[model samples]
Target chain A: MTTTEARPSKLTPRGRATRERIIQAAAELIYEHGVQNTNNERIRLAAGVSGSQLTRHFPTKESLVRAVIAWRADTVIALHKIPQLGHLDTFASLRLWADSYIEREELCRGGCSYGSLAGEALKAAPSLRPDVADGFERWEDLFRAGLTAMRERGDLRPQADPDQLTHLLMAAFQGGMLLNQAADDVAPLRDALDAALAHVESFATHPVPHDDATGGEAP
Target chain B: MTTTEARPSKLTPRGRATRERIIQAAAELIYEHGVQNTNNERIRLAAGVSGSQLTRHFPTKESLVRAVIAWRADTVIALHKIPQLGHLDTFASLRLWADSYIEREELCRGGCSYGSLAGEALKAAPSLRPDVADGFERWEDLFRAGLTAMRERGDLRPQADPDQLTHLLMAAFQGGMLLNQAADDVAPLRDALDAALAHVESFATHPVPHDDATGGEAP
Candidate 1:
């Protein structure tokens, strides 16, 4: 069946539970071992589901991968929406947001959920590029929403473009994570976020004082 | 056999030619299909080499992957070293370097050579992480060397850190390419590079006139 036709919303309560279990198992396996290595049999064993159940929920590997992408996107979106971290309208809040990502040991170690998936998807599953793209768009919108709020509040200069700034931050984040994954260090990520933040800060209507403790210089 | 022992330098002229052919074929396949999908048999077939020849050159997949990583790194380094693009000491030259990458249709469409390899290497070939890390370090040094020149010339502010700025630029380039691949568009890459260049420009001792035509605003 097509991914659309197999939507979880159409399933019964028990079926939905089974599907969630399968997706959770697959997501964990994919994150640990990547999409190519995580096969149906392993996922079946991990989820404690029978072969029939997996096929019933996700008839194709592509469908399962799409679910995992959606799952990762949801998890990231939820994390970003945490009350203290959601607001990006203020410079302090933005810095805090950047710090929150840098401080996530799991993210530093495992790489970004979307970024890891994007690489695999782009290489092996080109059809899913749009799904990954959608996830990024939603993620970007989260930042854009906050920056737009800053613009509306007169916190950002008239010439500053929130959309463009969001792209820069997203680039910093994705690129930094890739470097982190390669080098097995967090410094690249921190530097990237710092640079993007410094760029964002340069557009502030009333520039925030440089926090010497953070080691981020004024743009 | 270990990759070190199988070094191309140790081979005779014909053997070295054979090895180069295999690596060239594998690199093309890996870039097009990815590491997981490019198997030894396919590589042998594509390279027009017999099974024994392929096995002789690369006893294991990891060995072949390492060779491919080195090949891609050398190619990228050579491209960056083209006299016109090599110097990053000046603001104008830095902009040119960023533009050259953004204008490469193949990179935009197929994704970056190192970035694509980095993702697969980080996931499937943990043993090759150091190799990829070394490649990135070398790439970063290219930019760092130029920024250092700027610093030595008193063109950069005293407080500006060339090493950190190099990280930021690398982040923008890598992250922009990933976003470009996912979104199937070039604007994200352009926006990211523009933002990074603006950030780099911010550190200039005597600011270059903002090129209004490029749409990059002063930081």
Candidate 2:
């Protein structure tokens, strides 16, 4: 009843399915109830897996949390992988990225998965810091790559600092999501993203002016 | 052993002190361990209170969490009450407020107390939403008041929207604190606040141009 017997690459189709189920259940539970409140027993019950099966996949809650972080990182990165959000070199695409999060808030009825992890559980669990930090760094890398593209395309001013802007965008995003969840409203998220985007947009060379009267699409 | 006989106004001096001690202990414990992991027994042990004494002040753990939310709000608001931060009519005072939070991060070694509460435990404890929400609203009001003062002074353009800017600033703050705590670095928080203040500065009527080279004092 240990992972030693069945490594991920060596697992049978059914074994892989079972492991995925358990990890998904654990992620949902941790995302909702938090890592500290969640237990192996509850995850087992929720996943409808036997004790041996649970132990075979993830013997410890810490291991399971680490898996959930990887799992959630995939889910989040996949959202950004969509063609529009993937490049994020254009104003419309950046708005799409913001909208995607607002859509997620409507579905999850909570904050960003990463924000929840970082704000409470990650700090409390020192051992999990690297995993969480890696996930966030990957998130920042995505935006950095996008901004780099914008700069190369002459869409952004030559003076714009992509590294600093990337970090600023991430901070605004994490902050926006936290406030949105706490207030159970989307306005805060929208305002934060809009302001951050405007800041980024300010650095555009030959910027297209936004219509002041209609509050038209960002240029 | 419940608070059946003693009320806040009617409490003797000793009773008040004991209650404050319990609340202060609970706040620290919750801030450190979160509401889910920190239980009644731990609170009692940490506060050095007997079961009867603990129960007399807070009959349930939920009540204690609510009290901690209120107490932390008071602590956070008190920091902003300093004359410079109370009315952020000038750019200098806003930087002071932002810097105060950065100084706090160096000391606290965690995210904003309110941000942590909202991200995890408060969401799990649905019954405590109103209390936590009210606490956040009060924090927003502080910023709103300051922004309103700026508008009244003709420092901000007539087009400036204080209410929307208030919400935006709060979102950036909570978000920035979160990233800073997670990365154990101050750069993200600094970037976020500087970006937010720059956004506000864009609204100044008779703008003072900052000396770009020296990183001179904010006007």
Per-model DockQ against the true two-chain complex: 0.66, 0.51
Candidate 1 per-residue lDDT over residues A23-64, each given as its tens digit: 999998888788998999999999999998889788889999
Stretch of 10 with least lDDT, candidate 2 chain B: B210-219
Give the alpha carbon lDDT tens digit for every residue of B98-209 in model 1: 8787777576777888888888888886778899999999989889999999988998887778877998999988989989999898878888899898888888889687
lDDT of 1 at A91: 85
Backbone clashes in model 2, listed as residue pairs = A175-B175
RMSD of 2: 3.5
Error of 1 at B46 (Å): 1.3
Q: Which segments of model 2 are wrong by more than 4 Å? A: A1-7, A103-105, A209-219, B1-6, B103-105, B209-219
Clashing pairs in 1: none
lDDT tens readout by residue for model 2, A29-125 = 8787778778888999999999999998887777777788888888888778887665777766776777677656674356787678666656567
Instruction: Provide chain B TM-scores across all predictions.
Output: 0.94, 0.89
Error of 1 at A102 (Å): 1.8
Give the TM-score of each candidate. Answer: 0.95, 0.91
Compute the DockQ of candidate 2. Answer: 0.51
